[model samples]
Target: MTTTPRRYHITTFGCQMNKADSERMAGILDNMGLISSDDPNEANIILYNTCTIRDNAEQKVYSYLGRQAKRKHQQPDLTLIVAGCVAQQEGEALLRRVPELDLVMGPQHANRLQDLLEQVFNGNQVVATEPIHIVEDITKPRRDSKVTAWVNIIYGCNEHCTYCVVPGVRGREQSRYPEAIRAEMEELGRQSYPEITLLGQNIDAYGRDLPGVTAEGRNKHTFTDLLYYVHDVPGVERIRFATSH
Candidate 1:
């Protein structure tokens, strides 16, 4: 008897960070023996790792969700999930908007996909954007073929830039313990990831909110401090970071 690999289609929208998240998730799915489908209608599982960075991205995700929601009515077995910023920012409000969605999870919860899906197949819909300590990036990411990779030095953003919903949605700046960040970088080095981009909402303001942090050389113990902290992670050739406010 031959069984086809369970197929999944992931529709990604938003920035490099979200794209990175989706790739990591796709890696997780690959570990589970699921193949990705280019066609949305043909996949047994439909996962939308949504983005809410702009109004257009949010609306687009909703429109796609609507179509999938309607499809779920006809194909009762079609598993539906909405992940990333919108799922976190909106939470159960998403269920109010589209009750047909099987799961709603946020960026911080990205590493928990397999466990959440396990709960979904168990017949319970889930929303898991609650703030928690991002455990560790133990799952192998199905990275894009570029020699560059994004390594999140911190989880969540404390800077509640008024126009931004990151703090409310993704939670506060939880910098990975400097030690852990170095370890992750060391591993990436072993994998030959040549260029690494440290992720954050505001890199200039890293450890201001966290305790046990102080100045690093001429600067405060902010993202820059951490940069010096993990700069020597073995095998890493280069490093960079991004944030406007």
Candidate 2:
């Protein structure tokens, strides 16, 4: 008998940032030699890289998680992961709501999927919501498009908007080092990626949390500096970004 190359299906909801996170996570899985799947029920691994920007979006994740939870009960080998904001906000409580889930990790944990899944394979369910120092970008994501890509220049948020819970859930901002970002851009160029949209909950706030040099010998860092650093990377045709107030 032959086994499959562990298939994964990701159901994403919410905003452009979530969509981009899904792609990057997908890219990470593909590099781990997993194949993509369209049906969550058929996949050995089902990842719901969800969002909780609205009440409906959060409730919907539970409903959808319900169906998969049932499937996992019937298919003991099935691996189910709940990722992104909902996982961040609810944390381990998500497991109480759906005890069948094998992993619950937040959005900031996207790049660490492989290690977390390994823990799951060892018969330990995992929840990685506690704040962590952002790792260097090394994993090659199985990018979704040749025409466009989402490059996260920063991880997490610090805004602490009164109406939002992101800063608490995502933790403090940790910008990717300038050299590593350039290296990734260069790799994307080699892969023929034509465009890259710089992603962040606050794109305009990219480097505010990091140390930097200034024209007047003052401590200064801005998203614009990061932009100019990557602006001329080869083979990239276009660049766009967003900032949420």
Candidate 3:
């Protein structure tokens, strides 16, 4: 007897950060031998990479989850996941709201997709919202663009602006090592992706959390310094960045 091949569909909502996170998770799934599916209803695993920056976005996640949750009743073997900001914010409450979910994981836990899914496969419902120092990305992203790519130079934010939910859900500022950032860019350059966007919740705040200082008492890894650092990577034609702050 032959077993059915695993298939997955991911629906992403919100910012470039969320989009980047989705691509990474897709890479993780791909590495696990799951084929990508365009239709959520046809896939064995369905993921909603969520956003909660606005009330409407948050509400939309629940609506999407409702439909999938209903489908889960008939397809008892289907795996359901809610990821990104809403997962971070709602935590176990999401499981309470949607008991059919197999995994509820945060933006910080994006790189741990495989491990969490392992727990799910073991007949466990997992919630992984606790803050962690982000693992250095080693998984290749299933990027949507052939010519452009997103390189995350930093994760999360430090600001507490009353108008934003980013800091609360994404956790504290965690800068990727500048060396790691450049290594990713170098690989993208090798892949012939001419345009690369550096992503951050607060782009200007890059490298402030790193442990380094210049002899002149200046930050050794400031965003300006980073720009100068990776400016001449081979095959990269253009670079851009996003800032929520």
Candidate 4:
């Protein structure tokens, strides 16, 4: 008799940032030898890369998690994970609400999915929400589109808009080095990707948190600088940006 390979499904709800996070997480799962499943129920690992931008979005995630949590009872080996904004905002409290969750991680922790899942494989429930310097994105993203791609030039938000949860969930602003961003874009260009979108919560403020200034008292590493730096990447025909506050 032969056992089937473990499969994973990710249910994502939110903006493009969340979608980008989901792709990176899926890439990590792929690297771990898990295949993608079109249906959540059929997969041995079910992950909800949740959103809390709206009250109903948060409630919807809970309802979905409830179903999977119940399913876990019948399939004891099933692994459940809640990641992205909701995971960051709720932290350990999420584990209290959904005891079936094997891993809870924030958006900033996306690159560390492999290690987090390893802990889960060891029979430990993990919650990683503490803010840290954003890690460089090295994992190959299982991108949703071959024609276009979303590149996060900066991670987290530094704004404190009273009505927004992004600042709390995504943490402080940390920009990726210009060289790193260019390398990723160039690779995408080589792969025949036509367009790339620079993503951020407060895109206009890209390099504010970084340590640099020009003689004119202006930040030397602004988004405009990034644009000029990457405009000529080999085969990339278009460049765009989103989520400016």
Candidate 5:
């Protein structure tokens, strides 16, 4: 007997970081041979790459989860995942609120999508919210734009601004090695993506956590230095970045 092919739908909510995370996760799914599906109801796996920056966005994730949780009763084979900031913030409470969820993973775990789903396939409900030294991204993102792409130079934020929930949910600042950043851009350049956006929760805070210092006591890997490092990538005509402190 033949088994039905698996399909996935990823609904992303909030920020360039979350969108970037969604693209990476989608790439992982594609690598695992899952086809993309437009309709959440028709997909065998439904993933919500969420944001908890605002109260409304957090509430919105629960609303969507409720509908999918109900559907899981009848579709026992369906896999439901809550990933990104809200999942990081809520943790196991999300599982308590929606027991049908197969995986509750944080933004930091986006690169581990395949491993997490393997546990789910084995009939296990998994929660992976603990902080970690983020793995260097090797997955090829399914970029939403043919002309533009997002390259994450950094992950998380160090600031604990009273008004923002970013630091609490995204954990501390972790910068990707400059070599990896340029390599991703180089690949994007070869793919004919002319414009690339370097993404981060706090774009201005790019290389503080990384170890390195210039002879002049300046950070060797500051965002300014990074800009210069990847400036000459072949085929990429323009570069942009996100929110600043």
Candidate 6:
């Protein structure tokens, strides 16, 4: 008798960032041999990659968590996780409210999902929201579209726009090396993805933290410079970006 593979369902709230994060988390689950499930109730792993950008988005996360938290009382083996901006902001408080959660990890910890989940399987509850230098995202995101993809050229933000929570939840600026970004795009091109959107909380500020100097002795790795570098990625028809602030 063969046992069925565990299935995962991720309910995401807010922005392309949240969607992109969910895709990467899904990729992590897929790499672990977990299958994606359409119905939340039917899955063995249920993840809420949440957002705190709005009151409504935050409330929706709690509502979803409540349902899953209650279900976990009966299904002790259920692996429930809360991840993304809200996870970073709330941290241990989320684990208090939804004590059934197996893991609560921030946006910066997206690529560390496998190692974190290993801890969960070892009978540990994990919270990983502490600020850390953003690691280069090497995980292949389970892209939502075959034609378009989100490539995180930069992680986190340094700006403190009056109404923004990104700088707080995502930590300070950290740009991926341009060579790594190009390699990711090149792979996407080979996979036949025609459009790639480079993501950042404050895209205009990308490359400001990287170590480089212009011919005139100014910072060299501006967004325009990045565009020129990535534009020639073979098979990529269009390149785009978000949140120029």
TM-score of candidate 5 relative to the true fold: 0.98
lDDT for predicted candidate 1 compared with the true structure: 0.82
Q: After superposition, how far is residue 47 of candidate 6 from its true place, in Å?
A: 0.5
**Model 6, span 1-245: residue lDDT tens:** 99899999999999888888889889988989999999999998998988899989999999988988899999999999999989999999988888898999999898899999999999999999877876777677888798999988777787788988889998898888889989999999999999999998888888889897988997879888989898899999998899788
> lDDT tens digits, residues 121-214, model 1?
8999999988877777778788776688887766667667788777877777776666767887788899988888887766666666556633
RMSD for each of the candidates? 2.6, 1.8, 0.9, 1.2, 0.9, 1.1
TM-score of each: 0.88, 0.92, 0.98, 0.96, 0.98, 0.97
Pairs in clash, predicted candidate 4: none
lDDT of 4 at 226: 90
The global Cα lDDT (0 to 1) of model 3 is 0.93
Model 5 residue runs over 4 Å out of place are none
The TM-score that candidate 6 achieves is 0.97
Clashes of each: 0, 2, 0, 0, 0, 0
lDDT tens readout by residue for model 3, 1-245: 98777999999999999999999999999999999999998998999999998789889889989998999999999999999999999999999989999999999999999999999999999999999999899899999999999999999988889888889999999999878999999999999999999999999999889997999998878999999999999999999999846
Candidate 3 at residue 15, lDDT? 92
lDDT tens digits by residue: candidate 4, 1-245: 98787999999999899999999999999988899999898899988888889788889999999999999999999999999889999999999999999999998898899999999999999999899887889899999898999999887787798988788988888898889999999999999999999999889888887787999999979999999999999999999999888
Model 6 residue 227 CA deviation (Å) reads: 0.7
Q: Model 1, 67: alpha-carbon shift in Å?
A: 2.2
What are the per-residue Cα lDDT tens digits for candidate 5 across 199-222?
988989989888989999988789
Error of 4 at 172 (Å): 0.4
